[model samples]
Target chain A: MQDLLLYISLIAAITYLGFKAYTIFFKKEKSCGNGSCGCD
Target chain B: MKKLKVALIGNPNVGKTTLFNRLCGVNQKTGNYPGVTVDKKQGNFTHLSHSIDVIDLPGFDSIYPKSLDEELVVDFLKENSGNSDVDKLLFIADGTNIKKNLYLLSQIKDLGYDIVLAINMMDVAKRKGILIDKEAIAEEFGVHVVKISARKGQGVDELKSAILLESPEMKTDKLIYLKPENHGVLMNYVKECVSENPYKAFLNITQENRIPEINVKKWKTEEAILRYQYVRKIIDKTIKIDKSLASDATTRIDRILLHKVFGYVIFMFVLLVIFQSVFSLSAYPMDLIDQFFSWLSGTLSSTLPPGSFSDLITQGLIPGIGGVIIFVPQIVILFLFFALLDESGYMNRIIFLMDRLMQKVGMSGKSVIPLISSFACAVPAIMATRTIENKRERLITIMVAPLLTCSARLPVYTILIGLLVPDQFYYGISLQALVLLAMYLLGIFTSAIAALVFKYIIKNKYKSFFITEMPSYLVPSFKNVMLTIWENTKSFVWSAGKIIVAASIILYVLATNGGEKFDKAETHIMTEFAQLPDSKKDAMVSTYQLENSYLGNLGKTIEPAIIPLGYDWKIGIALISSIAAREVFVGTMAIIYNIDSDEEMKITQRLDSEINANTGERTFNFATCISLLLFYAFSLQCMSTIAVTYKETKSFKWTSVQFLYMTILAYVVSLIAYQMLS
Candidate 1:
């Protein structure tokens, strides 16, 4: 039972991290309009 | 037939790299600037049918540098006069912050180079209601102005075309010329030889005014106030801003985030979250790596015959090298967050908020980044200290940096803490997490105290001022984060793996063969234990033989001294071997116990069952665990740190002193902990 619980928690954590990695790559915002954004 | 050399210069966080990468398309190499640790990048690409090489110089606000790193960039562009390979300069300017960005552009332009301006981040300007007329800017400056968004790869073609077609123009008659005596007559000589145009005189004047020499010092004394006055006048005429648009947004955000009272509270909260994520989020990948290595060792041992080569592969190479590689995931994760925080421009605000308090602790606000990065690993942190120019200040920062609990010490701390500290909560915080937090706090406080002490003792003839560019905040890019993680993790794993594998093989040989003396003692000890119960007798013989071996004799010699610190002879042996790298402590313990056991069990269980002969007590008790923790926390355990220090300081004496001081400090601290706890 302890092993099962550990495995479940591990899977959940991996899934959340995967979501974060995905969003970091895919998320898009409008180009900063003011040359001020410093994103050359 | 000549190749054009162009430098891309801009303020930090101004998408300079994004543009460089866009143009060069992965044809880039990264290294350090000559004689300094600042990151240097260079790349080449063919644009507008002309092959051009772009040098991405470290970002700075002015040509007059206040730090060693900034001086490197400025000196490279100005002092290398005979190297007329640079055909033109592409000055990247952030359109929204045109007034501040132009501060650097104007300085570069006055050097009398064929110049073109890449007004980048046009997308951001539109959103912020900033209107810029490209034609008007071009006409006023008498230089080509191209709009670009490097991140989106906008206007790059035009930028490339402009560079190919650009040519030097004759200077205007009204250009100012100041022939100050101390302006290094060498620069004037070079300028005259290089250019037969009117701008040569103007270039000489700008060079004389900017470069620091004996004569320029006197000129600065007389016209000190006029420098900024000139800057202001130029800014007022070239840039126009609507004052009504400057609102309380930045201040309002700073109120809650940088509030004197809440600032520390928020910092602690955020730091806690980062720590938790580093441990919790990385646990799965770490476990997977651990399991994979164990399986590989078992499979290789089973497949090969019982011979020296098989033993070396399974016992020496796989477990030894794999143990160090397993921690790569955690190190990469930690650096990923650091890079994200740095790229998003939030790191500058952290420096600004902590500046006053850090100054009181005898460190500049800039010292915070290097010190904080030490948590991930100290090698890069030590390298990062190059940004600090004051020799005394840099040395002090380097001295205390190792006190911060680095990721290399994490495995040891986690094992010891799990065995000792409970998991219960105190005021909604995990007890284990609080203990971890306390350990981190201890490192920080010790470092600060050491810095304060060093500040008063070390006297040097150098002056330092804290000036940093505050970049606007933006979301971090995933591509950059992944690339940084991959590069850092690959280097760390490869370097640490080689050392661990070679050390493991040598350790295995020493443990296995002790010459004729060990063989004779082992036979006698086995005969003496022959009458006892089989299991008990086996354990006694194994322990006896180990104590009589060469490694055992070395451990025994130091055992008497370390006993007061709660370590048994065997633990002393492990500690001595771990000086090569702290992660080896667990692996050494595993190997020692594995040789003794009849049935192969988990390394943790084997260590848990071992007992000390003298006290008839567990070797890893609360007092012993805490002592070990304090030792690893303060000691310079990695040889890589020493190598990096030697490279940075360029002296063996400094590195040796750093190692000696840290080792001595670790010993004293551990001794006190064991005595008090016991």
Candidate 2:
């Protein structure tokens, strides 16, 4: 039971973090740094 | 129709690539120039029914050719002119910084080619309250001028139209000539070539004045100063600007950023922030990559038949290559920051601030750029040393560049620090991060010492000059940063991946298969140890098997030499493999321990269980760990670095000497470290 709880917590935390990163990197407004928008 | 060949020439950081992208439209191919390590990029586009072929020349200050990059550009212009004629020469200039840009433009104008001027970054100039009289300037120089904002796709069409209408006709009929007393014979040749058209006469003068042989003595610093003085006179008349405002603004900014006391403080603060972000921000991506590879290996192992095929997929390729690929995120993050700093023109300030400090250490301020860049990877950083004109200085820069802790060393350092150092904070600074920073400082200090030593040892007869330009600051372009990061990360993963896979497979085979004699010996050891405790019996069998294996024999042979440094045979094997790449040490250790352990165990757990039989002590105790860290810190462990040095120096003797010296340095330093720490 203890091992199962640990696995569940790990998965949940990873999923939350992955979702956050994806949103941050993929957002249209935020993706303005490189040469994308041509504004320096 | 014959393809029109055009050469794009400019001063550095003049929106040359932004213009190239605008004209060529993403259809580009990059390769090494013939017989040189310099990158060659060519792209084709159609403008007004003419097929335009553009060659993006490397950025250079002058055609007099001091450094390798400058020589490459100048040589290409000279050689290509001799072969196929250049249809049109496009000279791009930053509109905001026209004075420095025009110095190169005037030199190109004298080369006698059909020229068109593209005044780029017009938008930035307008915002900065600078007005450029394009028509007036064009009339002054006798060339077609077009205003362009390459980043915004503004005036590109007009620029293309102007290129379509280029003519090899001089705007002025009067010729201007410089009659230096030293060039008596060359002046006679120039006089013979002069005619009614001054542009033609100038071209003829330059052609006749060209030295057939590379007489370094013929060109001196005085000549360069004289040439620049002539250029300054031209700019004083042609260019009309509010110099007071520009100089005042630059001075105000320089006071804070270039301040002797505050400059280093700010640089350290920024560097600390960048390092912290590299570790903390890249962690999520690194973890994901690690987990993905672990799942992939597990899936392949379970699905494939239990044979060499599965072994190749799971143990040999995935684990080995994946370890390298996981570091790509960190490398990209680091490069992203570097590109931003460069594009925004802040890098010039860094050079200016560090010039005095570098001079004290027997290196010019220009060496600072290459040294900082070596933190990412030494290959490009070493390539960048071509910008340093002095042969001895360039060679010394390349020699010490690898000492700067590169991104490749990050994984090894992090893992070792995790095992060795406590994760505590001192006055709000992470202890682990401080240690990492200390390693960087050690690299810099060691590189400075090496340069000072070389200054006394190597005798350079030629005089070298240090001259650098500081461009006005602007916000960095996002597109350029992303493109740089994407290209560099792709190259790193691909190049490192290829070697890692092959090395992993070879290591796996050596650990798994001993000869027929070793197979018999392993059975004998297992039978004899059967009556002992299970843990003891398992260790005994592993030890016996390793003794007879190919790697074991090689390690045992080197054991006597490395034993004083507190390394066992396993460490000796790792050291041998690490010569190809330092990161391989961890992966090789993983494979060796995995093959010997009876119960399936994580690599770190198995390593923890490893003990020295002689002392009955933990093998990777504090002393040995410190020794290994110091060895890697000092050694030239990357084969790519040696190969690049050989190519750059064009001599096997220097490369061999460099390898021998670095290896000896690593051994002696590590020996001292182990003894003192133990």
Candidate 3:
């Protein structure tokens, strides 16, 4: 059960990071130039 | 519901954003200075059984745009003129300064726009013993007028009612006319090609250079003179001012705040107070957060059965996220002070004071705002360069903006500084705070030098000029300051949290597993330390395994290049991870050191206790900490900032040059600092 949970969490973390990198690099956010990058 | 699309038009520093916030019941930023709204913002609200979409355009003084921000408004007007894309223009004007505002209003009227004049800041005008005849102005301009105080929320409902109730047929007649005989053929060509409205057609022809005989420069000048003449006449008839009751408070304060020498002294004093407060005020809350995370890590480690999964939770996720979560108090205090300075109208005077110095570096006072805003983040600061008119100046501003110390760098600095610098205070200001201030000043100094270099390289035909409005000082609204702090803190945590957690998991996996050497670490340690106790043997084995782990091999690969900078494999690993985001450096450190099931020492304490195997000395010595701080100060380590620079400049050459330049600067400077100190 512990090994099973570890694999599940590892997969989830990988997927989450993959999705985030995609959005940051590939996804063209609709910027009307309102500083929506949350960096503001 | 019926829909109405209206655009809010105004001159700068006239409370347009304040009114927009009131109308939408959402907090868009409002400052007592010009160029606050550099981008068009859209918000919607349901009122009087109609859904109204309001477009808040960046402010400008006249139809002819002086900056990219003002050009946005001109572009919006040109696109919507006589096309019915926009149903109404909600023209906001400062009641206390109606004369100068009327100049722009007169120009807009000539374009035949359907407008309702909302005279804002009536309370301020009343206090100054200035009275406006709303009916007379309305009668003269042939548009509806509403008195309002957007800050006080006094006339927002009435303004909304007027928006839905005003007739659509109330378009203003032309205030400036072109003779048909003098330019009949040009007018016909413009109307057929660009716009049917005569003034708009003339404007398009002149702006596009379609007709050389039109004498665009002469016409624009004459047009301005005529509009001002008409505006002066209108103001004389419809306004009254009593000189005796007018207040001189702003003038009196400006005498001291804008003084030649004392101005800069006061500004430096203000920065000192802000940085001091960031350290003093955030100490208790930061302590609580640190203790809480430590408790959580200890509890999870003891409660869960010892396994890989338990290790991941206790070592990877908890420590990683805790690294950034602990700095929330400092981030909040920094933004809170920034918001207060902006709302109090002191920031504009700083711009005025800095204009001379900025011009010496080949930038106008306008670049100061973007550079200052860069202290928060480079992405938005680069976007804020739209307010600058000169192309070369704007490009330079974008290039150097990332050099400023943003909130992301705060965590890295804090952890490193806390590890080495004593927490002692002198004259009621902590030593750590003074170091932080020096780091920020170092950023500003370096950026100015870089700007001077770029100014000599990039060439432009257009001249740079600085124009800003000094707004009346007012007490900052507590609600607005708190909202800014909350929004920024929430955004920082959410955005950095995702990256830190993911990086932690990947790093955890890397540090824990390896090839044959890591697998045999326990056996080798047991044989070498046969006489040691069981606990010491286990620690030796963990250390041996970590040194042979996959993460260790990767760090060793770059160890040769970084060794001159006094960095080992672990510091090299953290440096590599920081390229993802600056704050990730702290998270990487936490994950790298906290992998074993030991007592929950704070990350700072862990780092302080770190020792170099080769030298048998502290890993993070005075030389390494100073070198690391200097490196982060100059390095373009953020992918987001790199992406934003590309987006803003749209040139790979510039972006590549910026990245290489900053990296080289960081390397050379850090190398020198480490060598000299060591």
Candidate 4:
């Protein structure tokens, strides 16, 4: 049960991480300069 | 109804933005025209039951744009010319500085633009005892004159009514006429070249480099000299002012504010107050937020069914997000002060005061504005360098703009200062506040040196001139300040949230579990501490767990590279992770240190209590703290700033130069600081 919970947490974290990476690199935010890559 | 497009044109600091805010209220959005760095703000509002689209053109001395922003403004205007969408032009000017602003007004008039001259700051002008013959000026310029205080909302309704008076056909049929310094000499020549607005033809001729034109006059002329002479004649006839009162209250304020000896002293005092206030005022709310997050983390750990998933939520996500959110108080406060200074009309005075000192280091007074803005963030600050027309100076400004300590460094600084610097008063000021001020000062000092270095190395031939106007000081508007604070706070939260949350989850997953090596190490630690107290044994186990975890292995691999600077593997991990974004350092440190019980144990407390396994001494001593501070102070840990530099310069060469020099400087300086202190 402990190992199962750990695996579930890992999956959830990796999914969120994937989404974050996609937004940061692939998505273009309107504001360019505060901290995000200057794609505005 | 489709909005009627109107261009609100003006000189700098003439309340055009104030009028724009009044007209558009909350219905506006900021944008940039394609391929230009200049910010374009377009908004919609109802004026006399007709929906209006207002676009603000950047301020410039002459229509012949010397800077990129000015060039874009010209392009935007020409792009919208004669289009039914853009039918009216509102020319805004400081009523007192009508003489100076008339040069642009004359050019617009010569282009046969249907315009209403919105003379702002009339209330301030009236107080100073300056008077304008509105009827006479209106008759002289062949345009409607609206004397409205945009801040007070006086006579804006009349201005809206006048916008409708101009027939729509004038927008399309306007002829451009070129009025030379001596119109008598160029009349015959002008008659032959007459087209729809000969001045438009003149603009096309002179600005061929911008508008792309065929053969036209290769005219090298002081067109403004002629226009100014025309403006003088008009002012001489239609404007009246008492000569003695002309200097106004600004001169009186300048007497002390611009004094050579006291100016620097006063400036330092102001900075001390701003920093001190930021530290003190934010303590309560920041404490509440911190404590709440702590309780939340603790509650989750106890309430959730005992498992790794519960541990992940309690130990990782809550603390990681809290690490970044705790500094929001300071960010909001710093920006509030900046906005207040700007609205109070004192920021320009700061630039003026710093101009001479700045020029000694190869920066213009204009560079000061960008540098000041850099305190909030580098990307926008770097973009602010658009006003610096001299290519060399602008490039130098861009290169050193990031050297300033921005809000991203705030969390790192606050945490370090809390651990290293005692919370005591030095001469009635908080010691931590003084240390914070010193960090900002260090940034300015290093940037100056960097600017000086760039001045001699980068070569350029474009002429540089400083032409800043000292607008009359007014009480800052609270509405404006609140709006500014809200906008900046929102931007800071959104941008910082994205990276901090991502890095937290990634670091958590990496830190909690290692491979077979971690399992072996954990079991061995459990066996070794079998006879110890539960608390001590658990502490040892957690320590061992971090040492053998996946993130731990990575940190150990890099520990040798950082050991000389008094950093262990945990600090190494943080230093590595924060390269994603500087603010992530705090979150990285929180997760790596294996902190779970968020009770009253601040990150500062955790860092303060850290002990080296071998030496058994406190890990974050004076030498280590100073070295860490200097490393972060001098390093280019922000990816956004690099992206901006590349985008602006369109050269990886300059970006690499920026990244390398800053990194090399950080490493060398940190090594020296650590070695010296130890």
Predictions: Cα RMSD each: 14.0, 13.7, 11.0, 10.4
Highest DockQ model number: 3
Kindly list the per-residue Cα lDDT of model 2 for residues B47-115, writing each as its tens digit: 768889998988998766657888888766655543446788888999878888876776666556677
Show where candidate 3 strays beyond 4 Å. A31-40, B1-201, B204-247, B596-599
In model 4, what are the clashing residue pairs, if there are any?
A: B175-B197, B176-B197, B176-B198, B176-B199, B177-B199, B181-B226
DockQ, model 2, C-alpha based: 0.02
Candidate with top TM-score is 3
* Model 2, C-alpha of A13: deviation from truth (Å): 40
Tell me the tens digit of each residue's lDDT in model 1 across B467-566: 5765566679889888878876776676555555555665666665675767776467667666777677766666776777767777888999899888
Candidate 4: residue B449 Cα off by (Å): 0.8
Chain A superposition TM-score per model: 0.61, 0.62, 0.72, 0.61
Instruction: Predict model 3's lDDT versus the native.
Output: 0.84
TM-score winner, 2 or 4: 4
Instruction: Flag regions of model 4 displaced more than 4 Å.
Output: A1-40, B1-95, B105-201, B204-247, B529-531, B596-600
| Top lDDT prediction, candidate number | 3
- Candidate 2 vs 3: which has more lDDT: 3
- Whole-model Cα lDDT per candidate? 0.71, 0.73, 0.84, 0.79
What C-alpha RMSD does candidate 1 show over the true interface residues after superposing them?
15.1
- Residue B333 miss distance in model 2 (angstroms): 3.0
Error of 4 at B412 (Å): 0.9
Q: Which ten residues in a row have the lowest lDDT in candidate 4 chain B?
A: B167-176
Return the candidate ranking by lDDT, descending.
Answer: 3, 4, 2, 1
lDDT of 3 at B195: 46
Interface DockQ per candidate: 0.02, 0.02, 0.40, 0.29
